[model samples]
Target chain A: MLSKKVILYFILITGGIITLAPFVWMLSASFMYDGHANVYPPRFIPDIFTLTQYEVLFQRLDIGKNFINSLFLSITVTAVSLFFNSMAGFAFAKYRFKGKNKLFNLLLSSMIIPAQVTMLPLFLMLKSVGLINTYMAVIIPGMANIFGIFLIRQYVLSIPDSLIESAKIDGASDFRIYRSIILPLAMPILVTLAIFTFMGTWNDFLWPLIALTDNSMYTMPVALANLMGEHSKDPELMMAGSVVTIIPVIIVFLALQKYYIKGIMMGSVKG
Target chain B: MRIRYSAPYLFLTPALTAIFVFFFIPVIAAFVISFTDFDIYAINNFGTARFIGFDNYKALINDQLFWTSLKNTFYFVIAAGPLSIAISLGAAILLSSKLVRLKPLFRLTYFLPVVTTLVAVAIVWRFIYHPRFGILNYFLEFFGINPIDWLGDPNWAMPAIILMAVWKNFGYNMIIFIAGLQNIPEDLYEAATIDGANGWQKFKKITLPMLAPTTLFISIITMIGFFQLFAEPYVMTQGGPLNSTLSIVQYMYQEGFRWWNMGYSAAIAFVLFLIIFTGTLIQFKLQKSPEA
Candidate 1:
């Protein structure tokens, strides 16, 4: 019995260490001297811990600009997308539109169509409108995602019809009810959706890679990828760039994990 | 007078309008554009683009690179999908067992990878797989194993990506699997224990059968996500080491954006869509067949 228990602990701890090793290495290597990361035994400890890598990243490489660019894009997209998706979701959940079910089913069925299908034409459309290389290209698509709307609608369904009906009887305007009642009641899922959208937008790479051409306009992942092309030799600097790109999303996920995990359970309820 | 009837529409207008323009319209336009000879010249002069019906699809049949990427993508999905699913189920079962302590810590540590930026982690894994100095090769030497060129070697390139992907993704489905496990009634296990059934037998009969639906859901979603393998290969390898890691989506991106082969790219996207649809349908069919 003791032997069996020992095996389980050994397996779990070993697996856990393997899973976390890269992240630990990323932080450690990011602070190492320029070529020190490329040494024998793959130094887990920094012999000369210096801020030189970050110095080069921020001062010479101007990664701080890319950091701000990613920050701005993620926040703007999250705020706008949450508003648009929730309004539509509330309508879908509470109101009696002429073709609500049909419209929703149409949207749901088309979710299987890969986002790549829209990339070509959307790129052309944005190019034609001179929106290419601008933040608008990312914002336009991010403003309304089907999954976000679906998630919000699913959550709003549980917020009783009676509550909404009473609010209506009290002469609250539709928008007023949505603002005063629905928003507060639906805060849990909203935070969940917000995290999903924020992380998604912040971590987004491909669309921004295509949409924003110049280095100044590039988001962090795109900027990091761009840096990889020019500085493949500088592993420490590249690791620092990665740490900068990844920290914000990790912080967000850590802080609001309850809602995030709850959101997953809600999603799996349908499954 | 008729304000109530219009309010819902009003609420939906902005969102629906955005979806229509940015999503639905673009889908239709991609289909239409797939039938035309759209390239760099077409980008500069839209008027010069001519309708070349089915040419892109025809060209795909003859394109070696297209076939190579399709095979590579399928290889990735087929290999990584099952591997990740197994790992997720194993981790879930172990964490959910009565003997486990500090389950929350295990789960949070496991799930950290899921929320991190893919490009960042991919970059991190790239270094971790570095031939001469990577921790992966470093760890292997303790067991009398030779240092393998993980990313540079064609034979190991896709497998390296697969290993990193499984590590990154298993935590997600592990959460779902844990949820599924919690839902399985404890009475059944107790009842089986009274009947003198062994642990392996209980698992084979009760656990696996009960978790079939969750497994199906996990499998389908995992397969769909895996089919769109781009960023890993893009960042880690750029589909290099003799294109062993070239994925279908990455190939499409190269064709459409890099070379301006919009029609060809659109055709590739549709084929991918068709593959996913059929794959999903097949999963449903397989899941249902057992019950029937």
Candidate 2:
């Protein structure tokens, strides 16, 4: 029994280190002076913790612009998507309409079609509209997603009809009921969907890479990829750039992980 | 004027309209474009696009890069997908065990990688796989192994990407597996014990059968996700060291976006979609067959 316990702890500790080492090394090396990282024994701790790497990233690389771009894109997409999707979801849940189920099923079935298939023509369409390299390019396609609507609809369905019926009996308008009753009741799912959308948009790379031609308009991931092309040799500075790009996501995940995990479970159980 | 029938449509009009205009239209356009020869010349002027039927498909057949990318993608999915599932399941079982303490801490630690940005982690891993100054080679020296060029060597580049992918993804499925494990009734274990079943026998006969549905779900989702391998090699190795790590998606991206070979790229996307769809269908059939 003792041997088994020892073996379990051994395994857990070793696996934990393996999972976390890259992040630890990244944070540690990011503060190391330039070229101070490329030595034998691979410094896990810097001799001197300097902010020069970040200074270079902000001052020279201008990653701050990309940072703001990522922030703006993530927040805007999340807010806009949540409002639109929740409205559609509320309609699906509470109201009866002709061809509603059929339309919803069609959207659900099409989820299997990978996003890449639509990306090519979408790029062309956006190009024709003169929206390339604009925030609208990223925000427009993201404004409505099938998964977000599905998630909100599932949550909205669980709310008892009596509550809405009471609100209706009070002579509240349909729009007023949705705005006051539904929005507050659906807060948890909205938070989950918002986190999911933000994380998805924040971590997104390929589409943003294709759509945003101008460097100034690039999001963090796109900017980081560009940095890799031009600055592959600068390990410390690259680590700093990575840290800048990843910190917000890590903050968001750590803060609201319960909702995020709940979202995943909800998505899998139904989907 | 109370609860008018048009309310639902009014509520849904904005979202439905956006999805229809943006998503549905683009998908059909891609299929149509795939049947034509749309390239840089066509992009310059829409009228220049030619209706060249089946030529892109024929060209893909002859294209060495497409074949290489497909082979590499298969190599990654086949190698990485099962390994990830096994690791995730193993971790889930251990964490679910009553003997384990600080389960939440362990679970959170394992799951941290799942939420981090893939590009950032890939960059961090690139440094970790450094030939001369890497922690991996440093640790390997204790066993008298020489430094290995992980990202630089074609032989090791894909393996390096696979290792990083497994690290990044296993935590996700681990959470799902934990949920599945919790759903299993504890009485079954007691019943198995009363029958004098040993640990391995209980696992084989009881746990395996009960977890089949969850396993099937995990396998399908993981396979579908793994088939879209792009950013790892794109960031870490650039599918380099003789294009050993080049993926189907990456090839499509390069052809469609980089070179503006929209028609050919669309064909690649459709092929990937078909592969994923067929894979999902096979999983569903396999899962149902055991019951029947």
Report fnat for all candidates as fractions from 0 to 1: 0.80, 0.72
Give model 2's TM-score versus the native structure: 0.98
List model 1 lDDT by residue over A1-271, tens digit each.
8888898989899999999999999999999998999999888878899999999999999999999998999999999989999999999988886888999999988988888889999999999999999989989999988888899999898899889788878889989999999999999989999998999999888899989999999999999998988888888999999999999999999999888888877777672
TM-score of chain B of 1: 0.97
| Candidate 1 per-residue lDDT over residues B1-292, each given as its tens digit | 2358878888899899999999999999999988988999999778888899999999999999999999999999999999999999999999998888999899999999999999999999999999999999999999989999999999999999999999999999999999999999999999999999999999998999999989888888899899999999999999988999999999999999999989889999999999999999999899999662
Give the lDDT of residue A8 in candidate 2. 92
Residues B12-96 of candidate 2 have per-residue lDDT tens digits of: 9989999999999999999999998999988869888888999888998999998999999999999999999999999999998
Model 2 per-residue lDDT tens digits across residues A57-171: 9998788999999999999999999989999999999998899889999989998889999999999999988999999999999999999999999999999999989888889
How far is A249's C-alpha from truth in model 1 (Å)? 0.8
Candidate 1, position A262, lDDT: 80
Please give the DockQ score of every candidate, comma-separated. 0.84, 0.81
